[model samples]
Target: MADASAGRAGAAEEAGPSIRTLLLLAIPALLIGIASAVVLWLLDLVSGWLESAIWDGLPHAIGITSDNPWWILVVLTFTGFAVGLVVWLVPGHGGPDSATTGLSSPPPPIGTLPSIGIVVLISLAGGVSLGPENPIIAINGALAVAAFARFATKIPPLLIITLATSGTIGALFGTPVAAALVLTGTVAAVRNGGSLWDKLFLPVAAAAAGAETMHLLGGQTIAFHLPPYGTPNPIDFLTGLLVAAFSAGIGILAAFLFPYLHAGFHALRHPVLLTTAGGLLLGLLGIVGGPITLFKGLEQTGELLAHPGDYSAGMLAVFVIVKVVALLVAASSGFRGGRVFPAVFIGVAIGLLGHAVIPGIPLGLAVACGALGIVLVETRDGWIALFLGVALTGDLTLLSTLCVIVLPVWLLVTKAPHFEIEPKHGLARPPTALA
Candidate 1:
């Protein structure tokens, strides 16, 4: 018995970070978390101020509202040209093209951070339809890695990336649970000997700090005031499944169109022209979809929820279609942003449409299922999709249903092409000016 106990102790000690090491790691994790939240908060604050100035102050001064078609066109086109100049003339070319990357792409070189920050702010303030997730994650990850490499030389780069990624996600979602859920599959797949929770310890700690800090900083919450989803029935399940499948199909279709759009835009062969044309198209889309379809879609989601009666079934359908195309264009045309936020908006629109068409489905359930399906396709992570579905509606009753709905949706997208662009030869660089 004594020998067995000693053997077990030895094995356990070898399996994971010791308590002391964990404690040491926790210090930096907390710091990184707090820093990440502050960075996100600052970026949002500046962007919000800029967005207001451009859309409100400038437009009013010019004797036109922001929603005027000409104003939208001019601002968006100029935004593209400005962003293009940054990519063309600025160093590091605003990091890698956002279309070719995902939420967890490798950190860009430290030098690229400035240009990335510039372009992301422009996209946000200019009413581009993409989210800040991808670029912000890249920025934070690169900074964390560089800082740790300089000061804490012993820490691995990959660990820094994980911590920063978790912290940023926590800040974005206003909860550490989001970070944990999003990272579960990746963490579980590692060939490490420690328990999964043990492996998750530092990242979760960072996420917790990030979430709390962001909350203190007055970051907007992701939840909505939708009607509750009560008991589920067989018919509800059938309708929910259909809604989820339909929404996922939309995302899958967008994914199918991604590469072709990316290739066509790249064929323009100059960042200035490609992004300018891209922004022009987005302006046209905005005109058709209205002001509600603009920006990253978070604020727009709130608007849609606050006055559901204002939009008809047809308008809701139009919102879905327009936003999907907008997301494709923004992502494919060298705009620096993430696809997740716009996708969430698309999902919400689809859900509203389903409810309007059926009238029998609960609003909360429809929205949750719709978000689940489209987010699943955009993120390719069941956990994130499930989290967003519940988070957006703030209803736990839909959890089991979403879990079931995600299965078939996952199977449908599992074999489909991902919503990312791959370079035909080697890694595709940002397009430079034509000689």
Candidate 2:
């Protein structure tokens, strides 16, 4: 018994790093955070430039106006061809189909980073209904790991991954606490004996540095400008619950359809044919939904909210359908990106529709519930979903309501299929993927 105790103690001591070592490593972690933020900024700049040129400038240069539906179709179809060419011919197959992977999944080889970046940039610029979060994280993670291995061999690969992910998350949401909230569940699930907060210390430090750097460099926030939800009435709670539940149900339905869409797209068995078809479909959806349903939805979200009165419930419903289908197409068709931002847009539309129909519920609360439901369904992480709900509306008061609202929604989606793709190895049965 004494020997076992001694062995366990030794193992614990070895597993935990000393404060001095951690503090010493903080410098590199900070540098990594700064670098991650810079990479995101560069991606944003380039994507914005390309999106403007390809989606707007080129068409205008040819005398096409924004109202012309055929122009959007032509541009998106061409985008499909371009991305297909890159994915088919480029090495690393454009860095794995994102629909099949998690945000923190192992990155591809460092040599594949450039190709992945190019592909992601093309998707982002081409008005695909996906965000840059996943690919950017993978790109920064791979580069950070390689860079650290050269000079900081003592640092564990796991720690490097955590720091890079934290930094990228901070940049993505424009706040360190965003990273903290997103990772809290992951850190808590670790079996190592220690305070969860202690495990989070280093990663939080990196996130803080990353978030601050982005802020200093003019990082934008996704906060919606809306009137605050006044005193919470009992009826508001029921409305909130209903809104979240309905949105979650919609998201789950989409989740179930995800794998089939993925399989059908891959049925082409060639990247060129698969991605080009996906692009053409996306273009058709865009033509049906118009310009608002295109893009990653960050800027489009604001545009939608800017004049909520401009759109009817039917129009908002169309937005929801088009964006959801576009997101699925983009993800399944081998585009490199994340679903969070597009989900946000869809949630916003859901919230607006809820408010329009109900008329008694607060807009802010409706939006929060909408975001809460969809994000929870997509991420399967309660903390992230709640945070997104409150964060998007810039209302901390909504947290308590969301806390209660996420319960039933969670129950509904707990055993449902995840929003990820099936693995290639076929060894591990994905949580609820298609056979």
Alpha-carbon local distance difference test for all models: 0.90, 0.85
Error of 2 at 110 (Å): 0.7
lDDT of 2 by residue, 1-435 (tens): 999999998788647657787688788778888999999989998998998888778878989886478887877787788888888888877887889766667666898888889988998898888999899988988889999999999888778877888898898888888888877877777665666667777778888888888888887677777888767888888999898998898899899999999999999988888888998999999999999999899999899888888889999999999999999999999888999999999999999999999969999999999888888888888888888888888888877878888888899989988999877864332122100
Off by over 4 Å in 1: 1-10, 423-435
Model 1 over residues 180-201: C-alpha lDDT tens digits?
Answer: 9888877777664677887789
Residue pairs with colliding backbones in model 2 are: none
Show where candidate 2 strays beyond 4 Å. 1-16, 426-435
The local distance difference test score of model 2 is: 0.85
Per-candidate TM-score against the hidden true structure: 0.95, 0.94
